[model samples]
Target chain A: MSDLTQLTISQARAKLRGKEITATEITEAYLSAIDRANPALNAYVAVTGDKARDMAKASDARLVKGEGGALEGIPLGIKDLFGTEGVHTQACSHVLDGFKPRYESTVTSNLWADGAVMLGKLNMDEFAMGSSNETSYYGPVINPWRRSRLDTVVMPTTHQGDGGFVSAGGTRTARSLDNAQLVPGGSSGGSATAVSAFLCAGATATDTGGSIRQPAAFTGTVGIKPTYGRCSRWGIVAFASSLDQAGPIARDVRDAAILLKSMASVDPKDTTSVDRPVPDYEAVIGKPIKGMKVGIPREYRVDGMPEEIEALWQKGIAWLKDAGAEIVDISLPHTKYALPAYYIVAPAEASSNLARYDGVRYGLRVPGKDIVDMYEKTRAAGFGREVKRRIMIGTYVLSAGYYDAYYLQAQKVRNLIKRDFETVFAAGVDVILTPATPSAAFGIADEDMAADPVKMYLNDIFTVTVNMAGLPGIAVPAGLDAKGLPLGLQLIGRPFDEETLFQTAAVIEQAAGTFQPEKWW
Target chain B: MSVDLQTVKRVARLARIAVSEEDAKRMTGELNAILGFVEQLNEVDVSGVEPMTSVTPMEMKKRQDVVTDGGKAADIVANAPATEENFFLVPKVVE
Candidate 1:
């Protein structure tokens, strides 16, 4: 009766089990929504229409037999970083041009085995490098949420160069071209955009230094980056092996909890995947955090952080305090160092991991005079400016003379940052609370961020610490900014303690009701 | 920590990615800006701190040394930019 794409995973699951609607019906609703929205949003890079329908058809049959998984019939978007087995899985980079993997990512396979239907591959920052989706060779994903209260001032497309950013599904759309779009935060921008825009019921996203949570905060959705080893990274394109973890971006914390349960697992294929039972995250949803201790780290009070963001953090503390959560002031002195450390560490690993795409195997290749020249040309042509900058930074930091100064120092700083979290958590802190981003979403490729790329890197200042500490963190849409753009509050939990985050975030979400952008698309 | 144009070239060569002279000049500034930011790590006293490799305390996992997967060369090479005889094709390495 209603547009099924707007239903949360839990809501859709109940309706499917009650036989009020079939899986095909809901999947169709999402597909139709994508058809209408994607051209403007650039949220989906590849739409697996036939595969989705086939999965839904199978799900419909299973539902009739009274057998359905937790997410049976839920149409979800998979971030392009995840290998989807014969579908596009390029990590939204041109170097990975037209390359589709023959095997599914362990996280997606886990989602599939539990009956989640893939709507398509979502776009992202190339190799999950940047804070805004602009790094994506496919162009930036337009966040559905606009700057409210303004007469629509349409600006012609500015960044349309050789990227072949084909909007409107390979055809130009007037509305998209005319509007000055705001960026969905990266590197999980498309996933956040799709989930927030109701294009997908949920999305599988990865966070290598705040990719998932930052984008979630920007788009006003719930995103949780599970503990580093909680989800097997076997098939998810490797970024930073130590910091990268797969997570879910969904309409609400409950849906994030449900999706995360199905996405996390132990796998022998990945040596780093934790050998432990994946907890039932939904079981703790809505549970009272009566005696929970929430820590507010004094160190997170960085210079130049907006007055509104600080107010939001204080308001989040008040909400939890009202809900019986004990608010305690704590300090993570190494918090300021997390971003610099993450930059050094993430790219260092990215350079090593991305070296695999040297024209010898897969993706784009530009021929040259000889093998050495060919490698140089292929990578030069394949990678975008952001990717190249990172590769250069990574190579420079890990160079023979600079290894200790940059790479090793970053690793040491990482240890200190992790120690700060461990010290706080050891003080009986149940969870730590902070603003998700310095501010709400900015306009795509805004002059400020583009002038200095580090301005973009500063977007992850709050969220990157979670990755550095190897802890589970969730961003809950707390309220709106002065401009009516959604702002999120992040809750950081102990290692493998996602249940606490889910329960705590639910309280924050309850006090601060869910938000969705006006359907301008 | 300031990156020079020559250093950018050396690193680009090391990374095996072609950097045009002009782009290399641009990269020198960007790379220096990033490095200048990362130089803040020098402020922390990490004298005794071990450079952490693994976030979770786990040893290197080992399995029985055996062929877990093979015979999927057809599928594996499906994504190759160029291939011949089921192997990825590249420019000739030997003269």
Candidate 2:
């Protein structure tokens, strides 16, 4: 009866099954919402209006026949990174230049098999590089959240008799001309943005470094980067083979758990995909986390971190303690080496993984005198600045003479980082606790960090280590910042032990409460 | 450890990515900054530490040498930017 746009996947599934609300109604609600908000948010790069209605119509027929699947009639946004048959499945890079995939990615195919209706492809950082979505050749997806101007003293530039700072008359984060915009964290930014803005129920996303978690944290959505091999890399575009993993960015922890269950499966194609059965992660969630050892890694308490973030971390620790989970201060000494090692390892692997876009088999191609000239010309025209920077860095690190010093040494440090997590986990630390990011969502106008590459790289400080160790991590929106933006607390778990992560994340969710932006988009 | 103009040119050539003279100058500064940040890794003691290629300890799963699936040349070449009769077309190399 009311607006169906904001309903979570699980909630919508129940309503659709019960016939209280038809899938068409919810799908139409989201489509109309996209019509209203997408101009400002730029979340959905392509909206499949006809496909969604057809799927919804088919789903209603299935429901009438009692032949619905797990995610029957649920509309979802597929990240551009995931291949969808006959859809515009570019990885938000100019390099891929308007090419649609003839085959579906294993992850999307799995979701479709479960009867999920497709909304459209969402935006992302180019080839899943960059923390902010700015590197996308399609342009950055502006964050829906903005710094509330209610408390700020806006200094007037006009002639004022007194030297008093004036106010801008109680402005909010509306999509007005005067309001400054913040960025939804990236490469999974569009997925996070869509979920938060109620564009789709839940969107598929992948995390190479902090892509999934950081964006979810910034947008106040829940995102989980499952254990490395939990989801297959089969048809998804690879950024870094060992580091990239697909996950769900959802409105709540339960919805994320449900999506992950269907999204994860062992495929014959991906040899690295684990053969273990997919657990009903939703069943383990909301189970009491009492007697669980939650490790508070002292290394995450980095210098120059905002006071509010430190306070939030302490609050999370206190909440866990109150819930009867033991909060112990543990040491992850090799944590400092994580970002450096990650930058090296990710780009090195990316150099090889991204080599397939050589103007040969697929995607864009520019003509030249010879094949070599064609490759150089095409790559030069195809890739964005950030993508090129990474390719060059990757080429450098993996180059002769420098390989052993940069890439090899980084790999050794990677081993030490993994050892740190293993040591803590071995000592009976069930799940580790830390701030999801150093701070809240940043203003898009703050291009100072973007200009300086390393400063932008620091945003991945707390996140890269989990990828290095190949552990599961989840970002749960705990509270809002002083600027009235959402901030999240992360829970890192042992390898393939996503059950523990879901269980613990549920506790954090229950304690800190759910967060959603004020719907400016 | 130093990456000068020649190193940038060398790597760009190696990677098959064409960079303009202006872009090369800017890229050199950016690359230098990134290298400086990663330089912190050199300070750590990684003596006797084996390089980690993957997170899991499992070795690559082997399979029997047999053609399980093939003959989908049409499907394989469907996405090609340039192709003729299922063969990807490139500039003539011998000439």
Candidate 3:
């Protein structure tokens, strides 16, 4: 029982199958842990304890009868962005706070079919916009790591901050002077924090840009953003529709592999979801990447990357080199254009996708004197500042006058960025390696985002390239920074070649060793 | 490159979100900074090169032209914020 909390999804399933532990027991333990820790972490936005208990009890019954699902008895937290039938599926925004759905998302339905027990929905940025979870209507999630008490307050600063903050949770009150609170990373911060703290074995996360991967890196976990349309985006709350893909965030590569297999499926409900065959991802785990070609994209070198991150990246290269994988120095010359292209293209799509949230259709609505007033008042109050900024930018780019200059030019540049990968893959590059984020997690109140918006956007420089090229990118925790916060190495793969990506990432994982949660899990 | 705060307010209105005047000023500076960061693209020599839109050159997959649907129009309409007699209700846009 003491060790059950630390077991990965695969280990838990093995134990459950052997009858060493009942599903009921596992579910109960997780519920209790949630009760104990969730108050301080603020990871979950909603807990379906009654529903999970019922499901777990049935799974236990089935296991007793010699019928078991692959992931039967495993408790998992789902991001609130995924629509769940008969459950509130708010995207952690005030607009959709009370909105419940009549149907479940395709991803949730797929996970259910795999016999995963629903723990609850985790919190996220308002419509998945901010890098930090502070923009979430639910409030900022506290990191689970215990650090020496520092003299600080957790406030959203102008630029990003590195120091931890004060927790509004009772644990903070009880041990107020004992531990320091750090940023939990976002917009999938809750998912990252929850998994890191062992609230659940894994969680469902969506990435439009780097929402899933960046948070995973920041929180010291493994998160994979599969190729666009690899996982159906049917039930995901739309951010930038073409860019949004739901994937798994877990403790290790194997867990992520298992969860991704369970979540990917073809659905007629979503026109964009591919009808390709879901691979047996478990079979692909731990494969040797010897003799494989890994590309080190020459363009990812920014002007002032910290020496520590640069060293860790070199260390990863050393490990891969030792494993007999050939590291090719490749050039993604169009890399510089990726961020600009993404900013234009993502906003254009987002502007169109987010138009549905008008006062007339769905999500939030505020009554006003007239229809125009209603639309104005509802949107004016419903969306957050970042969302508004993005929407404005998106609309501006896609507008008639500026369309060619911003949107069309961006699309043209997007193709060039995509070509960078195409040329590399054509030249025998299997996977591309880069830093997950420009730097490690910064403090929530370190800088005013209002003042330095570009510095804030620069955080996604290493990430947005993959999205622009529509390739799979996974972020695995590589090492710690000068301030002791975790940094991550990102691996980008050719479309639909996740097996190579996973195998190569495992090689890095083998070298770096499994992420040992220092007091979080 | 200097964007007026009034334009920021207009953009905010079009985006359907509220932005404080202070936020507008901050966003202008930030937007300018981002534009400056993106300006590095001009240094790359990509003359006569076709911009790549997708990593894989696979064309969009074809589907049957026959119409198919979940037939849950009623359920979808039920979820709409404003509906009237099985139709999505909107403010009359026609003059």
Candidate 4:
């Protein structure tokens, strides 16, 4: 049998259907990988091994009877933010530590229907706030690849004196917790880490403001943030309600496409969910990209970006150019305002959405002398410093005195950013190419916790525009940096144009070549 | 922008969160730092530009004024921390 660790969904499904492999064996392989990887990486909060095996057994039975589905027996990781019936969906916050929902999210159900096995719930940043996974109460997810020269390397952890121990395949130890090692790109960092570490084929993730794409980029994995309303948001914990959308993080474009197809469905329960027809994303698999027009957004090249990132962007352009696609230089003039506008709009919505967790309904309830005291105590103890910071900002932005000045103006700016994308797309820009992030993953300690929070927020600068515009965007591995860390190139497509984006990404994937990171972790 | 601790205290009250004076001082420092970063927005020329609302251009969908919710009240209240005989229990507000 070939390495199940490196098998794509298409290859796995084909093998499963041909009776060359059983679903149980495939799932066990992924589970074994999770067991090997999760101890050091801390990628998952829960590993549903028993349940996954049971599901895999049923899937194998179905395949034996010639009744197979697209995701038949595929192993998957669920982001903890999505409610799993009777499972802990804490969203990495202590407030909902013991809270379990009675209903499963529509997206999880859809994937299950396609025969995907739930390996377990993956960790995420608290309430999907931070760019790095350090905010997760379950702890940070370590990056998979060791720093190396080749696109893929088998290297050792860099700041090893902190606390990293020798890992599998007989790798040396690193102990750098005191120096705060680089987090697996977050708030979906756990999912990214899992896929990169070969723990699972792919995992469900949410992108409010680059939560999905940024982490994928940081981890050198492929992440796709679909058009708003492309996937149902019902049962996913609210972060910034209007901006949040569920997506997928995977090892490659093809893996992401299969996961996206299974996850994209309409649900009547979620009012924000679009009732439009779901596309067969797999149909575009292996499609030609000869006549495609790829846009290069000049605005994304922020001042002082590491020269290597700019070079990586150029390298991606050259690859696409060689693949017979026209690369057009374009401008998203309002790009500069996207971060501020997103901060305002997302918080305003969050202020209202989170109002329900005031110690009266859901979340931790602290005892106090009176009802008002109860509200105050529960929330203060339940929420962490970062979560509280966002809530306060959310409340201030939505307050009556500040509403017109902050919230209303933010709404207006939101429109401008969206219009910027629409105007460019209207002008024949099929998709936009840009750096996924300004810098590669920095050590968690390198970020001065005392420093300005806005600097931390700036990390989402390049990816936030897609969220603001309600467009589809993806991060694919472009190349590695001088330090040997992987760098990602982002592709932003027109609304509902993920098909073209995937084909273009596939072309780049073929050109830049497959990522073969040296086994570092 | 050096936000004062007093302002942090006020912001906390407005945000319905309780913070001690020490925490307020720290938060003031943090908020000021964030605001300082946000102040960079002042440099951009957004004059005469319309602000954004939703990422998608579509207006919020509206349905008929008729009530149509199908969620069962019993099921919802069943999970509440405090409930009376068929209703949610809450602190008495009006005498």
Candidate 5:
């Protein structure tokens, strides 16, 4: 009765099982919240209100029969990247305009099998190619967290002819914009926002080059990019195939664990899905991390990292050390090159995978004099600027005479990056800790990030190495910055060792405490 | 390693995406910035490193080549912009 939307997935499970709340009631609560908040947040691209109600009704019947699945009656947001049969699954790209898959993604199918209710598709970077969520075809999702007005040092009252802003005096003033609109960190920005704002108990998100973790850190939620192949990529829209992995964004570490348990499974449809039993991640939530060797990678201490982020990293180390985790300084020398290499490798794979979007098969079609012209026109019209930029880079790298210099070189660098993690992990490091992002969430359409694509790409610097290594990583909200925005610390685990991440992240979550943005919407 | 305007146009053509002269000029600079960033990969000695074919260490899983799924022609073409009797309609390639 006390705002059913506030209940974590684990608590909702108990309450639903106890018959204290009906699935329909909770579903309606979330629907009402979404209806009210979505207009301001732009989180949900398409709300499946009718389907959610029908699913909740079925869940209620199952509960009455004293039978339920692992996530029975829990409502969740699906990233638009996932294929949900007969629903919008565009990966937030215009190229897939009006496209609906006839089959569900394996990850979503698994969630439904466990009784999770679909609350509809969430927005994301078009083709999962951006870090600021500004690349979303649906307008960028607004971060629920805002910088405190009291911390304002500069404010712009009027827009200049350029992207810059100026005060009425025609000069920049030292006052921050009053509650400036901030971007929810992206590609999975919507998932992070929805979970952080309590619009959904949890949301499914994918990470390729830190899509899940960066946004989770920005929005103050718990998100994990499980080991590559932990969740089948069968129906998820392909980004960088080698780096993409589906995970969950939830309000708490325990909620994230529960959602992940339901989201991950080995599927025959996806050959890359590992043939291993999915562990009960939630069961390890409160496990003590005594004697756990938490590695502090020295290479992650990149130059010009904010003092606060560095402080937060130290806080994480101190918390883990207090929990009896032995802090060991380790070196991953290839860290600086991971982002640059990712820029090459991710775009290369993305270009090849996106070739299927020719106007012939599905989605948008533009008329031209011939088939080739039509394909060119359609693609040009369909893709956004960032998508086109990535495709261009991808195509250029994989083109004749450049493959060895760019694509091949990046792959070799990727191997070195992965080997760095292997060396540290082989040396008895249980998990590694670092700041999830270099800084807290910044303003939507911030000038610097907008001027240059590379500036935006740097947002994933701390989180991409895990993807390159094919390891599991989680971003747990550790503390608030001076501006009241949340900052998160990431924990990287070994392959198929998400249970260890859950155990370690839970410790940090407990120590730092859960964060919730003050509801401005 | 920076891409020139001509190279940008060529890459866009190879990618099957049309680009206007103005956009191509702009992309030349953007692509150069990205290429310049990734050029740092040349700094590291990758002489003995093998390009990663797969991220995780696992043998490719093989399955029977037999058709296990079909009878969904309508579903397959359901979202296509133009379709005729389950066949996708496309602009004439040879004329």
Candidate 6:
């Protein structure tokens, strides 16, 4: 009862609707903390544990007939780019090897019709193409945050029973720390290392650029993305369809506003979703963002950025000016051509949504001497070398003598980075702030980001101008560096304003507080 | 605006994907360092900028020439690597 994987999905939906915890004991305490931290955080490439205990025994018979639903028996995870009917939806790509869909991914069928539960899939950045989930083929996921060792020794402990801590004379070992292995930032690096190592009570992610807010600002947690047709990319996996969307990564900011009010809706098989109406974003967290306005931008203070990400962007602009808001420095001047115009419109729409992986229909296949040498030896043995350097830089920027010099001059520098956030939210901005990832989580094949691919696409330079201005961003965490890691910040909003980014990331998560990774996974 | 090694082996043969000759000579220096970092959008002037086409401005939601869906031919070849009746088998293109 003390550590059902440290609760929070609105405290395990109020102890599974007050029957005091029985959605199969928080789905066997997140399947025994994902069987003891999934062999050091490889973050669930698939562990449906009999479909999460038969959907936590049908959410304990719909919580004994009170008929529950907003994430009924919680559990979550899902980001191997969504799909999940037969499970393993492979965007973690070995060209979808061993694929399995038979449908189900209108955002995990709207989080399994709101009763949630799945606890599987979760590793990404293969098709969702890297920011740093080390372009996974179900391999590199590890960041249960490590880097903090100047010969560490912090004994005094005492918080055990799986919320971690231990020592107080229970025989040493409270913090030896530094094992190196950093990178949790990514294509939702396994949903920010399974929600900062609690092993999932909230997961499902996807972004496109800044894949779910730079892996929820490198594993501190709380993502967002939304507002590019606010969710419903009809079953996820298709990076850069005008900067992909889907949200949630949780562990605060009201469990990412109750998992984006049940992973947003409006489908008709995704005519770019947005049919509107999705607000109880956990009823706007703490609600009073005083007189709002926020903004700050000054071209996101970029150059060499890191005085602890400009002292955590001046403590998230002094915690949203001590919650009474109105900060305003503004300017967004096409923010450094939004990461070289999002590496030319996300590899020119990832070379036409990866030309539907050409091995005739489904997953992998490599035989040749015909059908264009079996679609060039099954996409050269099914992608990965950062998906063939983004399908050869999205087929040489949509070829034909460089489609008007790199995809229509990177879509007119993505319409001047969406007219510099529509002239700062048409002046009188209600949310912009910045600094999500210019630094903080690194090292996992980090040799200057494996010797440059635009230095790992400049880790989405402060979250790709909110996915090139379709708007609504987020990120959160906002502090902790000098090697203790976790930094975050970013806000952005407007355009179906994700409730002013969960009411200003709950006032910078109530003044930079909620960060968790000390449990050396 | 770089990309050489014969335009990275002709854009990996128009992205069908195989790229050898030493991975098209290391993807012609990683596609000329991502086309020299998107050639910094040619120092932006975007002459009367427009190109965005749709990041959200709507008006494209058409739907009428109905069919709606189809009888799942085995859930669309279930995950075709070689299927037969459910169709997908390939490799011998018109020869």
Over 4 Å off, model 3 = A146-180, A448-450, B18-74, B77-95
CAPRI quality of model 6: acceptable
On lDDT, who's better, 5 or 6?
5
- Per-model i-RMS in Å? 1.0, 0.9, 3.0, 2.2, 0.7, 10.5
Global Cα lDDT for candidate 6:
0.83
Q: CA lDDT of each candidate?
A: 0.90, 0.90, 0.80, 0.81, 0.92, 0.83
Model 2: residue A110 alpha-carbon error in angstroms: 0.9
Q: What is the lDDT of residue A35 in candidate 6?
A: 91
Model 6 agreement with the true structure over A1-521: per-residue lDDT tens digits: 48888878887788789988788888888889989989888988889898899998998899899998888888888888888788888888887898898888887788878898887888877887887787888788988877775553555556777778666743333335787798887888988898889888888888877888888888888888888887888877887898889888888889888888778878778887877788788777888898888888777787887778887898888878887888978787778888888887888888888888987788888888788888888888888888888878877777777688878888888888888888778777888888888888888988876877788888888788788888888888977787788888888888887887898898888888898888866
lDDT (Cα) of model 2: 0.90
lDDT over C-alpha atoms for residue A355 of model 4? 66
Ranking by DockQ: 5, 2, 1, 4, 3, 6
CA displacement after TM-score superposition, residue A442 of candidate 5 (Å): 0.4
Clash list (residue pairs), candidate 1: none
Model 3 Cα lDDT, one tens digit per residue, B24-79: 78777655565565555555555665654444455566678887767776777666
The residue-level lDDT of candidate 6 at A418 comes to 89
DockQ of each: 0.77, 0.81, 0.42, 0.49, 0.82, 0.34
- Poorly placed runs, candidate 5 (over 4 Å): A151-177
lDDT string, candidate 1, A1-521, tens digits: 87788788888999999999999999999999999989899999999999999999999989999989888888999999999898998999888988888888889998889888989999999999888899898989999888755344444455556886643333332322225578899999999999999999999999988899999999999999999899999988888888899999999999999999999999998998998998898899888988899999998888998899999999999999999989999999998899999899988998999999898788888999999899999999999999999989998888899898888988988899999999988889999999999989889869988889899999999999989989999999999987778899999999899999999999999999999887889
Q: List the residue pairs that clash in candidate 6.
A: none
Residue A490 in model 2: lDDT: 93
Predicted candidate 5 versus true structure: per-residue lDDT over A91-183, tens digit per residue:
998999999999988899999988889999998899888887889889999999988745324444666788676575333324243468999
CAPRI class of candidate 3: acceptable
Is model 5 an incorrect, acceptable, medium or high docking prediction?
Answer: high
TM-score of each: 0.95, 0.95, 0.89, 0.90, 0.95, 0.37
Which rank order by TM-score, best down to worst? 5, 2, 1, 4, 3, 6
Better of 1 and 4 by TM-score: 1
